[model samples]
Target: MPSKRKLVAASAISLAIVAGVAAIYQTFGGESVTSSVAAAAPPAAEVDVAAVISQSITDYQTYSGRIEAINYVQIRPLVSGTIVAVHFRDGATVNKGDLLFTIDPRPYQAEVDRAAAQLASAEARNGYASTDWARAQRLLTDNAIAKRDYDEAQNADREALSAVKAARAALETARINLGYTSVTAPVSGRVSRAELTVGNVVSIGANAPVMTTLVSMSPIYASFDVDEQTYLRFLSHDTKTTVPVRIGLANETGFSRQGVIDSVDNRLDTSSGTIRVRARFDNADGVLVPGLYARVRVGGGAPHQAVLVSDAAIQTDQEKKFVLLVDKENKVQYREVKLGEQHEGLRAISDGLQPGDRIVVNGMQRVRPNDAVKPNLVQMSGDAATTKGSS
Candidate 1:
């Protein structure tokens, strides 16, 4: 009944229907369908990782302060007169008892000569009186002179001896004044500029004529202040003996010199709530000078061992500090931490960390907690390099 063309057309329709049916059947079939296409996911982002999690750290606090000298002295003239000559140049170093200045000695010398002449005259008078007394005594003993006359002669001789003793005392006083004319340095130190130069009149009382200023330099002092809390913290521990210290110029890094704690102020300042502490260092190199600002660090207590991380490695929230940790499966996790003082670029972790733990240092913003990521090798250069440690 059907023609050849119709038969061919029907066969084509049937084949199409049959294939569509097979596709539908496969979509809901009991047997599962398999395809080569994988899940459409975002590409893995590169990240930097750090494996060093915990370390030993000695906790420390910082303070700002100034420097001073251990032994500072102001030199003054003992007597008043024009400074005829100065033995030491301004700001020169001198030993103890070194001649510093000279005052005119002619005045004192004249007084000494006057006293000596008085002594000689007194001695001559005493010699004559002694002869008279001897003669009087002889006459009295022979019953040719009165006892009153002999007594008078003895009195005269005694007066002359008293005058001689007085004159000798005056002469000694003059000699002492003459010796004081030559001034001297009292201590061995580096002296400051001579406040009084040659021809500058100095005084005993008009004012304390400061001839020079001296400061002991071999063992100089470094003065720094600690806040009330910090001062108390160090004192609470047994620091009866010397505490350790190190110093450097304020702007310079790395404390280059080591010293010892020389003293601790007994009282805390009420106004500032800080206590002054001092350390003595041997400035043999003359590197440290007076009035210099320095970075001073004090060390104490038992050695502390703890987990440490770079400051950049740690993240801070409103009230807490945390870090991103990467697990073995390349998954990241957010870990909270308790932090102590930060020194240099590292922080002392007080809690919530351990050694050998891996952390995400670079690409932190790109990853979240429990994020699946691909950790690429961290190159030493670029913006992503924010202080990383080998994992």
Candidate 2:
């Protein structure tokens, strides 16, 4: 009977061991179940990716420059004399030949009168000499007077004729001096401050410095300099095509005038390696002035159809230029591109892009290679009309 009781106890212990093993495995299985639940959750979708496409990408370039007068001239006193009067007010508009100052014309006029009187006297003497010479010829022909007396009269007549010519020359010189007494403007323009006082002596002499200045207000010159690289690059692309220009004062917001290229520098400057280019604008409003610094823009390059993207879209890593190209499937692929030239805010994609190829513009930093994305295609319009796919 004791043996039977022992066997039953052993069987109960064995069943308890089997149940404990099953419980341990069940707890671990619960942990695995929780992990699977978390992993099964869906991920957030990516913002729609849009490809950068083109409309009309304009060809534009930028350069720094200054405003200049088309006709710049200096006002100087023409004659030497004491300044008697200031004809025009300082900083006044002057017409061509407008009197700017008055030299002491009293002295010049007196000299002119004296020369005129001398000329009259010389003319009277000449008339007398001519009559005497004629009489001498008649007397010599008839042998009415001694030959020596006739010869003496002829000599006096010749001297009087020479004196008349000298007097006439003196009168002309005096007239020129008198005209110079009134200093006049060489060109029509705004007169600068008076360089000479009313009482100061001025001329093309020791005090003959510039008395005033005049710069043509109409048809102003916009002078800008381009580096040698640019000149060569632009010239290589376009030859003799006129580039447009615009100018405005610093205080003035909107550009007040428009113009075109008038001339280019004769030679490239070796020291600075820059060439000066000038454009002419009609400043009929008299707003532009000489020496006023301004911004300049020019457009000249290979003529071809091209796709343009915002310069900001271009990303650079090390020495390579690259862009993020979004395919129609909303897949982002990094593309290496060759650049042409930048115009305004857009850059020409010389290679690696085609017309209507969408590109990543904003929010490009969050993207990675081969990352799945949802694309929100943005339309290119307005200034984008200038964007042409690579040619």
User: Considering every candidate listed, which one attains the maximal lDDT?
Assistant: 1
* Cα displacement (Å) at residue 231, model 2: 5.0
Q: What tens-digit string does per-residue lDDT give for candidate 2 at 303-382?
A: 56777777667789899998877776677789999887654446777788887777766557878656566665554432
lDDT tens digits, residue span 1-391, model 1: 4698899999999999999999897787634433212234576677887665354556566555566777788877776778898888777878888988898878888989998998899899989998998899889889998878888999998998898899889889988888888977777777888777889877787676788788777788888888877666664455624456778787776577777777789888899888888888888766666898888877666667876666667898789889998888989888998987655556677887788777777789998998888876442221234443443
Note the Cα lDDT for every prediction shown: 0.76, 0.75
Off by over 4 Å in 2: 1-63, 66-71, 145-147, 222-269, 272-281, 295-302, 316-321, 365-391
Instruction: Please state the error at residue 40 of candidate 2 in Å.
Output: 9.4
Range of the 10 consecutive residues with the lowest summed lDDT in candidate 1: 379-388
> Where does candidate 2 have its weakest 10-residue lDDT segment?
382-391
Give the RMSD in angstroms, all C-alphas superposed, for model 1. 7.1
Q: After superposition, how far is residue 55 of candidate 2 from its true place, in Å?
A: 7.3
Which stretches in model 1 have alpha-carbon errors above 4 Å? 1-48, 53-57, 87-90, 109-180, 227-233, 236-239, 343-345, 361-391
